[model samples]
Target: MMLGSSNAAVDHPTSNVTAFIRRANSIMRQLSSATLHKFVVKFPLLRGDADHLDRWVSLSAASRARRIVLDLCPEVEKFGDKNQMYSFPLHLFTGGSCVGGNPCVKSLYLGFVSLNLLPLAAGGSTTTSGFTNLKQLTLHKVSIVGDLQSLLPECAVLEWLSLTYCSLHCHDLIIRQPLEQLRYLRVLQCRLQKLQLQAPNLTEFEFTNQQVPLVLGDCINMSMASVELLLLSDDFDYICTKLPVALPHVRDRLTVGTAIRTEALVLTKAGAVFANLRHLILNVTIHGCPQASTGVLRLAYLLDLAPVLEELELHMYCVSAPGFPRNPRDLDAMATSPPARLHERLRIVHMTGFHGSRGQLELAHRILWSTAALDRLIMIIGPRIKVDYYFRNLTFADTGRLVARRYIQDQFPGTVITVL
Candidate 1:
């Protein structure tokens, strides 16, 4: 059962919201009392009364909805304003049995809601149980009050948990209890000083935030992980050196992203290795293009660490990068340097947001020249040079393709190259 505006992108008037609530009330009253497998109510611009919102949740609970999604569309303007968001009535689920007790909900997705769990009692312990059958939980743009750790013990069966753009009252988010069945965890754009989790069965983890101390205790089964850190200090070395140690068990796929002002790439610790790593993606944003060549060439050091890596993807973002230079001296010097040794195993290389700068071309040239096992090189032209930043002689893609055709096309006839 899905209600409210299907298109959350469009804003709705107050009268329409009020009418929607009235219509939803009528439908619920008219329907035959039965179980609901799924109940979804999405309204991006809804500011309904608390009583009306509580009624919807109560109806869903009474119907025994297995999956409930209450997405109030938390728009950009509602950010950081917890009072403006609706407070979810979690006490309705703190019961004993199914008939008059808790709803057997397996998945709960809440957006733009304030979730205030029960606080800790004396001696720092509390035993309020809710979401007992919840296997997956996703909270987006939500406000969390009290300690989050106090509420997780009740959710003993939670397998997947994702928190995006959520505000937690506490600075330290420490989940000491072992989530025995948790398989996946994702935390994005959440402000926290420290994060510590004990999920023994967790296989995949994704975290997006500024670099902070993280303790993923007993996560030996983690096979894939993506960590994107906003480089406030513009230090790329920290991402290269410290992250490998932090997430040591990442076996198959690994993605590391960072924004850097300085173009100097330094991998201090060469001992770190992704022994089982196959696919690697590097999402890098450079401040400028002139110094990009230096940092770009240094990526060879990182490639040396991933011995078994087969596929590599590069997403470069440099909007202010200048057009192709008349004389690319940096390209000539970089071309002579020996390629990253892992190129033999690297069969496919995909690049997105490519501006066809000298640095980008040089990297492409070096890879094509050295890698005999290379199968395909695909470069997707970016809109960086298309923007009227300055007077340009050619379009963004044209410049990149021209540079590639002039330098690389004739030399690398064996490999399949696609420039779009």
Candidate 2:
């Protein structure tokens, strides 16, 4: 019989109790939840109101979510409360501005916030104790005044770390604590005079800076299989001085861009070191080397170094002088010939700023003649030079087409040459 009855006076329904319970059970079935189990709270205008903060704290503590992200921005002065408005087992925390008191949030994904000396002193007692479960961390536009040695020890399980636009006065950042599990590390736009890394399991690293004598001493002592390094500088000597010691690991691909230099020593050194690389990109300025002789010699040296080189991208800037000879022989000698031990593996060549000048044309001819196995040669002519003038003025043999067309056909019979 049905237990629950429609009687208002009844303390507990008895007439239709069995059927009512069954219907209630069916209606109250648990809802399906999403697979992406993460919570994010981004309050750009967060003023840290007591009521709102308390409500947020309660919600966070009550939720059984897996991951949580809190991006908070409040007035600089109001960040002093020691008690966190919300305490939860969050896997990630991205914070802006400063929290005055040691908030319970352990894992931090810091962004665009600099911790000054006073804040470091105030927050010293918190000791980063609750951050044991933290795995990944990113620091952007942040400064560390105290010893990172104290701070790093707390993040025991920290695997991946990145620092961008940061300044540290310390002599060396030695990760004494075992970062055995650590894999990826990146440091960019940092004024770290010297860095020492000891992580053995690290796989990826990226460093970019303008500082001179930026020493990376015996830190990346681990055996890494793949690495990508980019060095940008107005002075080649500065780069030469730093690179030999910084990059000891054999990398698969290496990209380098240097300001114009009259001396060939720096380029020569680079060619010697990175020759075993599979992919090489050179963005060089050949301004002061008006003779083109020095430039050609440097290119030859570079080509000889990379024996197994497969891809080559050259962005060259050439400055012409009245007395400088625009001879085809000079061009041929520079582009066509290289060390006999050169990598026959080279399949692609991309040359930017092609002007179709006598010098450029001759260099193109040499490349087409030398690289018999070349699959593609793309020459992007600069807008400053007139293509019509180049084809009409330059001398050509065979069919009555422009000089550029005739020269292209004779030199690169099999390869595709696109003038764009």
Candidate 3:
């Protein structure tokens, strides 16, 4: 009832506020404010107007709104960090019973607003059972410390929760109960030290954290999970090393589809490998490896870990990072023997930024010859610049990409090869 017309619904919350308030008053007189619910107050350019905003929150609380969304910005286009954000009076969110009023909002969404959890009751919303009955909660660009620890327990039925670009200060982010109905959770770039989840029936989860330890205690019904590492460019060591020369250098006519024979590779030190992982998308910086040629060698180690991997995508990039340019063939000369055994499960292979470097070609040769059921081999050519700039060798001049394309074309004449 607070939002007047259908066209002027949630979207136009603050366009001519006085007129809308008048219309809302008329609606309240007819239908009664007790029945008024589900209002959104999104004011982008409402500068120097805290009195009106505070009063509106008080009124919405009085109506005991079921769903409320508040989006405010001092300036129309600036974000929380760019411009001064409008702070919502958290005291106004208390239930009508708490402050001798009746705002019982069920679903609350606050964006570009500050909630000062300190100097307030522990868990911030203790004054009222205001957020207890909520089913969904979403906060964007909100800075909070210990507030979440105290608040989430009250929302017994909270199902879906998403925190994006929220500045959270804590050592351990524990999520347990009152959130029994919590099924979906997405935490992106929160910069927490650790995240511990105990939602038993949690079905779907997507977490993107660089520096946090994630522990899912009892997500029994979890069917799908995606954990993306925040790959940041760092100083890489680009020591020069001997390119991997295939032992059975030439493709044999008799054993064309067999595992390519090579020297034993001193595998890179092993880490936790996903056994159930079927598909892998990897982004590798060219200079990240100890040497340029070993970039492919590094990938071979990854393949060894995931035996059931069906689809593999490797994307390569380099930001022209400075490196420790030195000669170290022995360290590079890991006795890398392309697995003599063929991985039948490995089917599809796609490599992006394919410049047909010798090391990369060696990798392609191994996969083409080692893989038994390969259905498609795709190569994507990367940005073109002067060849002499990176390497002085004329062998890899303009033919870098051309050579990669031709190699795949020649090797996989029967299989589908896509070149982009």
Candidate 4:
């Protein structure tokens, strides 16, 4: 009931201070038995000898508060045995030393202890009798070497759990508890070789690490129907492969990136796993390939596959023979236009890295000529083209102007040609 240390400190702890303490205690006696929920204490520095720290401990013990956050001065290294039995419903021990033991009375809501000065207590573990009501748990920068299996089991009602930068070297990280109650779970930069999550109700599962390979074996089956957002990395192909086959129920909204194709034929046979996809973004980096024509063919194939695809983005680095023949075989094939029914649905077409090379020009001309329902055709010249060569040389603008003057202006009088 007695709040520690007043704003003004007298020259000495006189009889007048004792009288003030007695008066404060009298006021506390008149108050009701309603429990206090939150308490925050800031200490500039413990002034006196070790005994003075004892007085602060006594004052803390008097308060029956549930939640406590202690911001102590950096110089105060040791909070003696007076600190040992100091427990609360939620305790946050920050900027101190030798504050190793657990300090939770009922259930630690969000306990974070930063023990900078001392090596962790040997065989020490944060034990919770049963945080049946606990909702969220976060442990950061702690060195808990042994098994964490005993820690979180009590937190059966935990909704969100995060362990960041903790060197947990466990053989198997198995969530034996039914995490159907969990909504969000994240383990960032932890040295976890394997993790098995069986949360049927988990909505957001995000794993961000370059080295760690997320193996979602059969847990994809337990994910709830309401689960929407799933962000995974490149090494998640094991899961991505099974995703379309196993979880065909939620294949529509799943967005994946940079995954390697273990078997190109198997993935292709998956038949547009992302069939209901709207926005498709690809950053395909093909190495040692003879030509970028492979990527182009794959893109054309994907165009047919993704029926609902609206926005298609591609970053293709074609590292093949610099110059291509003006009239490629594909252009000749496109010149023999397919049925008009095929072109009716076409609305917009954007092609970047247009060098106006023979093959590229042919491809552009074919695209412009073939799409009967095409409304907008955006052709962007690649930045690799030297500006000096483009403006100084007359041949640069000649073909484009000739095309505008001859084919477009004469043949398709209504179409617009925008040069950027």
> Of the pair 1 and 3, which is ahead by lDDT?
1
Worst 10 residues of 1 by lDDT: 380-389
Best by lDDT: 1
Between candidates 1 and 2, the one scoring higher on lDDT is 1
- Candidate 3 vs. true structure, TM-score: 0.67
The stretch of ten residues in a row with the least summed lDDT in candidate 3 is 250-259
- Return the TM-score for each candidate structure: 0.81, 0.56, 0.67, 0.45
Model 4 regions more than 4 Å off: 1-127, 139-144, 210-255, 259-290, 293-420
The digit string of per-residue lDDT tens for model 4 on 96-158 reads: 211223232232322223322222234533443424445666554334444555555555677
- On a 0 to 100 scale, what is the lDDT of residue 59 in model 2? 42
TM-score, predicted candidate 1 vs. hidden true structure: 0.81
lDDT of 3 by residue, 262-311 (tens): 22234435434345456655555454332355444445554555567677
lDDT, candidate 1, 289-312, per-residue tens: 464566665555556667777777
RMSD of 3: 10.6
List lDDT for all candidates, in order.
Answer: 0.71, 0.45, 0.54, 0.40
Sort order, TM-score high to low = 1, 3, 2, 4
Q: What lDDT score goes with residue 368 in model 4?
A: 53
Question: How far does residue 396 in candidate 2 sit from its true spot (Å)?
Answer: 21
Clashes of 3: 12
- After best superposition, candidate 3 residue 310: deviation in angstroms? 2.8
